[model samples]
Target: MKNEIIPYILANYPDLQTTKELLIHCHKLGIKYVELGIPFSDPSADGPVIQNAATKACINFNFDNLLAILLDLKKQNINLEITIMTYANPLYIYGISNFYTNFSSANVKGLLVPDIPFEERKVLTRKNHSIKNVWMISDNLPSASLKKIVSNSNFYLYLVAYLGTTGKNIQQSDSLKSTIAQVKKIKDIPVAIGFGIKDKNDVTNILNIADGAIIGTSLIIELDKSLNSAKEFLNNIIL
Candidate 1:
């Protein structure tokens, strides 16, 4: 099977028009999944790269406008599986029900709230909502906790490659492989490694053990430079 290459982009970064262009470029590149990050005052889980982006995005960020952009894209028949990533506070501020309703209308495929622990996910998950909750796990999680998270996960498990935040180099070790094996043994799930994948070789190497690679910081850096640079970077990695 072809491995999944999921790009994470900050919503309204630089501006909404650039965000729209990036999504179109992603779809043209045949990328099936794109993580749309909702800008928050404090993105604790991300590194300097994403933090800076979020800071810039929050200057003119409007959740409704973001949804409108997605809706417009859908109207034009440019459909990409969008997973909204944000902290728990933003969702609470938006009103949980309203958040789901808006995203559902925009045809979003999943939600990834890193700050919400597995135990607290019930607040965001509802049977009525079609958006799947994407869980993030790390190598350090206890076996029992890991099992519980994986078993309850809907779309796929996001395996954080390192212990730190995003935008770091991933050193593939036996422990990482062992963690993947443990998850596979518990249940059959597609595991995607995030938190430091930089290039095509990183994606290729990750696919050997996991089902997908989530590229964020490096891609964002290229995107910060220019849209065409971003497109070239994504093309090189996914090819």
Candidate 2:
């Protein structure tokens, strides 16, 4: 199977229309997965690029509207697997049960709650939600902790490439390679590395070790230029 190239887009960043259009473009490009970031007041895991975009997106973000965008894409037969990435606070305010109901109804495939620790994930999973939980693992995790996280991972494992927030340059160290190897040994789940994955070269390097590469900050930067620019950038990296 071809390695996955998942692009992360902030919901209603520039606007809802553009967000929808970008999803359509991604589908056309043969990209099966897209991370739709829900704007939050405090995005702890996000770097400045995505953080700034989220700040702007929050200005007019409507949770219902975001769901509607997904529903609309479904209506159009766009089958991009959307994983909603957000903090735990927003999920709490929205009510966890209600959040899962709406997202599952809209056909969301996965959920990535970065701020929630492994132990606290039960707070989100207690309801037996249909949407798969995407767990995050980093290079610094202890072997036992990593094993636990990998064993519990539902859809896939999101491996943080570096120790910092998103948008920094990835180092592709031996520790990262060792982490991926360890996860593979623990479980057979697909591991997708993010945080500092910038361009085609970055994606290419990641594909050498992991199952996928998630582009966020760099793609967001291209999107800031134009949708066409974003398309071009993705085209170069996706293969």
Q: What number of clashing residue pairs does each candidate have, in the order they appear? A: 0, 0
Model 2 residue 172 CA deviation in Å: 1.3
In candidate 1, which residue ranges exceed 4 Å CA deviation?
none
> lDDT score of model 2?
0.87
Most lDDT-accurate candidate? 1
Summarize candidate 1's per-residue lDDT along 1-239 as a digit string, tens digits.
Answer: 13899999888988899899999988998988888999888999999999998888888787899999999999989989898998998888888888888888786988899999898987886667788888999989999999999998768888999999899898877787999899889888888889999888888888888888899999889988898898899888866
Candidates' lDDT values, in order? Answer: 0.88, 0.87
Clashes of 2: 0
> How well does candidate 2 match the true structure, expressed as C-alpha RMSD?
1.3
| TM-score per model over all chains | 0.96, 0.96
TM-score of 2: 0.96
lDDT of 2 by residue, 37-144 (tens): 988877889899998888888887878888898898898899888899988887788888888889887769888999987878778875567898898989888889
Quote the lDDT for 114 in model 2: 94
Error of 2 at 157 (Å): 0.5
